[model samples]
Target: MKDSLELRTVTVTRYITPLREGGSLPALAEADDDFKYVLKFRGAGHGVKALIAELLGGLIARELGLKVPELVFAELDEAFGRTEADEEIQDLLQFSKGLNLALHFLSGALTFDPAAETVDDTLASKIVWLDAFITNVDRTFRNTNMLIWHKELWLIDHGAAFYFHHSFSNWEKSAETPFSFIKDHVLLPRASKLYEVDQEFKKILNRDKFVAIVDQIPTEWLEWEGSDFSANEIREVYLNFLLRRLESSTIFINEANKWRDASI
Candidate 1:
């Protein structure tokens, strides 16, 4: 794995089309690298916080041996989208004229269907553990946010994770709380090894790894218009939250196990 701080930067050259599947309006664009990417704009509804969650969540999941598309810091030039006819998209491009996030496009990949494909206990457990740890509210049956590329399950669209940052209150308490929403997880029924994987995952992630991931957040993202906290302070909060959350993994592990047992 590459260092957490070493994401490849690509300049978007063309906006091919708008992917209207989600509220964020991520696009299919070609970058200067001559590859297509699903670009997540910083100016979307959730703003840069969503980009932060996407970056952190994808990196953490990759560190855990999960399949995630390559993430890149996609640069949007100020003059790139001036020709867009859509008013909304034009405004979005205008506001997102900086470093955004994008995932390598998996050509011909199909959306994961729980009824069509089977997941083993270990993989499912790890995924459930990850979602609980990040407090990701997506990944329900209604919208799996998972894809099957080359016949392997790949996770995607983690903008919904780390919701505590949206409110920015009582983060310590939030870190320790049991994420009850794990019950709605699409893979929970197969995640019978939550406790087993919890121990394994904890060993793979450490304070240093967490710090490296948190430090990768661009300083501009932390400088929200009206926020009182400095960029460094916000980064520290993210690091502390992950550390505390890791120490308290059993809280969410037990919660996931409880739901898995009841569901089965």
Candidate 2:
């Protein structure tokens, strides 16, 4: 069941502090919805593709029964940049004068210190499966892009996932691409039910489900110049890669299982 997750559009009311922790320089902004959001700018470091990944990854996690912050579309006006002091930041704000992606600000969310905190095998396995499915490279023991909010693990910062999009030319051939990085996944050792998670996801994920996820992305985000693919063609390409990856002998799942077994 596609939760029918649609990205809500909110306008930026006030520019809060800049979250320098992220490489993209996302900001904590007050949205018109009466909530603060961690805005990922379309015109940021990696362009709109990163924002697209964040939306897709987060929504997928939600569908997979994983804890993820609410994803929304944020509107930014040119006038908001006038109050900024730094030239670089001002330029970034100015460039991102249109709709951007935002994740609901999790207040008082404690940092997930894997060393101190613990996760059950099932929960850990699901997250590991999702990361592997999405080919996310950001989640590692060194940099866990997860937080403990309301006593539950919440995933974040998916901009680094879906690296194959950067090389769309080979995306089709890369369907069976193994995410060797899963061996270093922060929760690999704890994912005792890795195979179970893989099977469950395979049962739920289908072409319609995957296409629904891609359809949620704004058309403008899909549109790009200098690419052989038009907006509609790019959507089909994304759907095709996901569909093909789910075919017989998924390389990522096998690799993850190997890592889990070796850890045991």
Candidate 3:
């Protein structure tokens, strides 16, 4: 496994197409490394906060033994999308002429269909626990945000996680709060081993690992408009939030158990 602080940097060579599935207009672009990636623009509607959440959520999931696509820092030159026909996309590219987030594109992958597919109790419990841990509200039955690639589950599109950063008031309180949205999770019905996996998963992550992950966030992303905290201060906030959340894991684990039990 690569070091938690290490992420490769790639330059965008071509903008193939736009993924219009969600509010953020992430694109399927080719990089200088000759690999295609789903590029998440920092200039999207959700802005840099979404990118920060994406980095934190994806990396944290990988640390806990889940399969997430390789994340890279994709660079866009100032002249890179100037000729685009779409005014909106052109504006987005112009505004995002710096380091952005992208995930290794999975070719020929299919969206996870809960009705036609099955997930074991262990995997389901782990996934549920992860979503709850990050406070991700987008992994409902309506939009699983998961893919089936090479006959294995792959997680994706975690820009919606860590929403507390959007408005950092009382963030410490938010960290300890149990996620009630676990009830709507697509795999909630199959997550019978929530308590069992909770014990094992807790051992896989710690404050040191979290500090390394949070340190991976670029300093530019932390300098959001209208923020009172400095870049270094914001980094500390992220570290503190993760540590507090981990210490209070049982609060969410119990909440997930409560919902899972009532659903059956």
lDDT of 2 by residue, 1-264 (tens): 435687779999988889897679998989888999999998898888998889889988988888889999998887878878998889899989888999999999987899999999999989988888788999999999999988889999999888888867888676777788899899989988877877898888888889889998888888776787888988888888888877733578778888788888
Give the alpha carbon lDDT tens digit for every residue of 93-187 in model 3.
99999999999999999999999999999999999999999999999889999999999999998898998988888889999989898889999
Candidate 1 local Cα displacement, residue 64, angstroms: 0.6
CA deviation > 4 Å runs, candidate 1: 1-5
* CA lDDT, every model vs. true structure: 0.94, 0.86, 0.93
Q: Candidate 1: which pairs clash?
A: none
Which pairs clash in model 3? none
Instruction: List model 1 lDDT by residue over 154-216, tens digit each.
Output: 999999999999989899999998999999999999998888898899889999899888888
Clashes of each: 0, 0, 0
TM-score, each model? 0.98, 0.95, 0.98
Name the lDDT of candidate 1.
Answer: 0.94
